[model samples]
Target: MNKILVVDNNPVIRKMLSSALEKEKYQVECAEDGLSAFDCLDRFVPDIIFLDLIMPNINGEQFCQMISGRKGLEHTKIVVISGVAVEAGGECEMKGVHASIAKGPQFVSHVIDIARKFTCDHFHHAGIYQVFGAENLFPREISKELLAANRHLKVVLNNMSEGIVELAVDHRIIFANPAAAQLAGMAQEKLLASDFAQFFSGNDQIRVIDLLKQNKIMAQQITDNDPVMFNHQQVAINFLPVHDRENSTVVVIIKDISKTKIAEERLRETKEYLHSIFNSVQAGIIVIDVETNIIIDANLRALELYGIAKPDMLTHDCRDLLCPRPEERSCPVLQEGKTTHLTTQTVKKRNGQTMHILKTATVCMINNRQYIIESFLDITEQKKLENKLHSLSITDELTGLLNRRGFMMMAKKQLRIADRNPGKLFLLFADVDNLKWVNDTYGHDIGDMLLVKVAKLLASFRRSDIIARLGGDEFAVLLSDSSPTGGEEKISARFESLLYEENEKKDLGFPIEVSFGVVAYDNYKPCEIDELIVKADKLMYSSKKSKKI
Candidate 1:
């Protein structure tokens, strides 16, 4: 049976047309509006469409043009139905409309005759005009104003810069405006004659065909976010479905976005280029938004230094991550109006451990927004080395005791303590009596061993005593809270016995001897450390002379 689609907003006209067509055994579908008619075409491809010129959403003239624009449905016949012939006369004469039916008392017969003529159905009713009150349906004369208005609409479409094309269900172009022709890189006449999909090859053609099917079947609009190459020019395409009661049409809007696409590609490449450079540097770099105090970006080194991932490193507050102290919260570069700063700072890592860093922070403007760029190197190891070197400066390399400089500094501190409290402090100075004689007879190495033995013997004193190798063959000790003059004599005798025992061991292959002097400091009569050292030296030499005797 021939399929007939009746498109009209009026229910009565739809009923009248459907009844007439169905009586002749033709399959009939009814739609109230152009959109509903398009939905109806999803299931039924009608052989003929009974279109009304006046309807909601898409009027009859638009419906006729859309139907004729479809690829496979070009052969489908359209007959316009009009209640007031002159009012819709210009639209009724649209290009795709094959015939016109004037609505009147003879509407039924006029509808039947037109269906019969188009379908060429074998079942024909004799005197169908008289049987259903049929009459000849002829095209009415249109007003000059309506014709001029139609011409104006065509003129506007031709003048638009955006390419406009109407495609059929089969992805074929049925109508294209002048801009569309130019976008396709072909003359308007040739573009209309050629296939639409033929303009794009390979995957682009496949994608466009799939898009058209979706648009037509779904009766919705689809737009491309990325531009596709059309005729060697980048263009953005939009597929909008325009449906008639019988067939589906998709309006494709093409915009030339080649320059925009190029600009976007260049911008993407520039960002990648800058990112590579940012990550390749040796220093850890972090960019912070000065206003928000948020870490806006960090490079690879920065991420590694903080023991954090890039995503977690960003958006962190500077005060929380780098500066934990309230006093250190103020940024020097930002508040002090300094363009740059070089300072040492402690950074807290993700694991809660702190690292010492030599950081250089600079203030800069990016896109008119203030930001701080912080570049730093980890100096925790360097700081440790410096502390070690400082310790070594105040210590004797061989004896592991405080040197002359270290002894003077400690002895002065002790006298200062003695002044605060009444205490008997003793400064003992000793000399290696035979160090030079041993050096002459058994080489300097043995002499050095003898001197070391004396140092060890002296170190045997109480832990509270400060033992120092003042220089070669010379040593000093500061004893705090010692006894009276009798107690000092006993302490000196105890040290002399320790040396006598070392000589019996023959540890250095020779005997060890030393001369010593003890000078007492009265807390009530505060004396300078230099004067104490001089007094001890004189007494030490007198003791050395007695050792020879």
Candidate 2:
């Protein structure tokens, strides 16, 4: 007989496990605690140990560790029984326990099967353990094949692309595959005895359970993008119910469609990006499909111009939705078949509100489908004060270079590219010398002109580089493909020589002197682009000190 030891502090649990194991014809032994279990081990060498984690002396984890290190008991399988979280049971496995079973009366048959699997020939005469009286339901010869099939089915279920879970009719989990456990953020053994409602939040639990009771597959989109918070993370769940005619068990497959949700989000962002650009222009933008000549997409300005209250009604064919025109009124842009930057007259708005609107349309393809992009700039209020103010915020009033905010935005983009390529990036800090002398001698207007001239010179040098004026007499440049030893120094020296030449040629009451310093990126060390600027600033101050000396 294959000797099996059942250890638990609870007498009822120990007796139930012993009865289950004896029914499978295994030689069963019982112990109330770990010390008694060790004594049982000394007398009878058991093939498998069923250990209860919470016991009086030397709990299951410690006992398993001790027994696993024994010289001849290396092959003896240790199965841990626990009412705690399954992660604790997994810790026991890492310490050399072979399997873990949840402690419950309903889990008795499962524990027996686990024992029989490890114990070789001891339980062959006894019939396989079955729950819900499934033994007499199938023929004896087919029973073995059915058990084998179920084993294979479990392997397939565990490896499935989608998550699979089986629940008793009352909603207690009976089986859960690894993917299902991972999706639910729980362990399989712990989930087996848990209620399905426990996995969902308050309102979600009620919503999901009600849906499951209807026995219909249900899908809903979740929109939380944060990975840490459950509600903040988005996922689409599809629930399917499984029925076993003989056992009356219901299995539900839960699939996590986070990828699909991400795709939908990207699509929405693209639409919003297009809308932002469209609203920024004084023109109204409209998109139409070429194949069906249907109005597929339009911006808010376009809807306002057309005087349409419901935009969805315009999604139909353009000819059916718009006012009828002669056959000769075909768009000239389409006739050209190339990018047409010409102005054309059109009666696009409602009949009563018809006006001479400048329309431009171009053909483009998105996602392998063809469409026409039409833009209509009203240009009615060209001299608006608010529009000019918006432009001034992004543009420098003195030097016409991008303002500090705009420069910061563009520099962030270049930094991202540098991070991806893992290459040398250089930041140059420049400060104009004798700026106070210029203001004292030549007046503030000439000082401003000198700054503007320097900005123009720097802008003409490298259009690709990001240039920004950090307040009066201070300017910064970001250079790509430059390093400390050769490429960076060469560029820095070229700029220095250019500044010296300009200063030597022009004399506007004060010298046009500038000090500069450069810092190259260290690929091995990860640092923010602003850190490079700080280093460059310190080096520039060092250069200014040397010039004074």
Candidate 3:
């Protein structure tokens, strides 16, 4: 096995070169810097030294200069490796080195050829081997070891993810790897010996060829974020200028960056989608620093909420805006650093007018900093609508009285309040006499008028009383207070007086008569509202039966 030395500052590049050389059964040693390579040189005399031009401590030019004056190592060959084009034509032009190969796609094959020239027995300068037919690039034997080694080189190029192509000094691609053919979306044979300019699309071909014409290194453009397209496929390309002291072989590396470009586009699109949603939302969203409690970012709705734009909003303290009444107000969400959802609060606007708002806030960690994501909705109009809906849900539309549901809800609440004071709660169930007969003879309009009249009579019954129309021709009344106990008698007397007054004012076909039933709630011994209602209903039915007889 031939002993090869690889000296490069980059560990990854050194490892890659060492692995390729070792695969060809060469004993490879590596050094990180020029100083380290010098130390390795004193101990191990390699057959071919693949020297890097630019490195820390002692560079390739310095290393070559130092070694030229020394003795006994005259048989050892130096193949200078220059990553830059200038270094190959300038530094690697030193008389001591046998050849110079640029660091690029053809790097591995160059190392193998150089190693074979010094070690292999059946190497002919002409019949030895030819790569791209540009110059002598391979060493060969008639059979066996050389044939397998040649196959191994082909396999390595075939398996590489990046496309590697050997171009002549005219920029015509003489050799194309399987990866290069795949990237170009064509067969390898179809691309071989084709002009390199034809593979690239758009203005990239001009810029690329111009740089190549100038014999410049593509390393600077390779490190750039922008990539070019080849055969409609996105590709990052690099050119390596390989000088053999006589002629130059320019190798092109094409790396497919389509997936990476697509990912970047998707991420940008996702960011735009999120931004649209944030601004379009009805809720005013504001992001504030948790430590300083200052407004950092806000959406359009948030700006509208405060009547201010960005820089102005940034000046305002978020806590001060929310808790303007410092003496009387404090935010629990801010203090506790926890989520508060749909909390109803009255906020004073910039104009000093108070508006009701439903605010929600949560603590969030953004970029390793604590922030509060606060969202709020102006619910002043909503509150007004909600109160109206609440009233409609409970009260009857026609008579302006509590419906059955409304009566029960308030009755329950009032009963609880009265129970605390331990006052007697009286329930009165009232029904109009001959209401069915009135509807049958006088029609519904007259029947409705009669119902309304009775409802008006009971409208001013008592302040503490909860009065409601339980159903058709039936009503419920709850009276519970500390002051008076003759509530039932008062209702009876008022009903009779209204009945007489109506009869006197108009000549009616029949008289309006009302029947009443009363029950007293035992607060000391509590019971449900249903029991009191059932008891009152039974009493009302009994009174009706007595009057009928």
Residue-level lDDT for 27 in candidate 3: 91
Q: Tell me the tens digit of each residue's lDDT in model 1 across 1-549.
A: 998899998888888778878889999999986656765777889888888776654567655655566666766777777765644444456676666767767777878876776667422333122112224544345544565686798899999999998765556565678999888877554554246788888888887777776775554433436566789888788777777675667788888888777888899999999999999997899999999999999999989988999888789888777663746878656766789988898767889888999998999999999999999999988988987887688788888888888888888898898899866888888988877789899998888777777788889988888889999888998886445457568768888888788888977766677889888887788899889888989999999898778
Q: RMSD per prediction, one decimal?
A: 11.7, 28.9, 16.2
| TM-score of each candidate structure, all chains considered together | 0.61, 0.40, 0.48
User: Distance from true position, residue 65, model 1, in Å?
Assistant: 21
Ranking by TM-score: 1, 3, 2
- What is residue 192's positional error in candidate 3, in angstroms? 30
Encode model 3's per-residue lDDT on 372-392: one tens digit a residue.
788999998998899999999
Deviation from native of the Cα of residue 226 in model 3, angstroms: 17
Against the true structure, candidate 2 reaches a TM-score of 0.40
Candidate 3: the clashing residue pairs are none
Instruction: Estimate the lDDT of model 3.
Output: 0.75
Cα error, candidate 3, residue 525 (Å)? 4.4
Evaluation by TM-score, superior candidate among 1 and 2 = 1
Top-lDDT structure, candidate number:
1
**Higher-scoring candidate on lDDT, 1 or 2:** 1
The reply for model 1, stretches above 4 Å from the true place, is 1-161, 168-182, 185-192, 219-227, 244-248, 287-298, 306-321, 324-341, 346-354, 362-373, 405-426, 462-466, 482-494, 497-506, 520-531
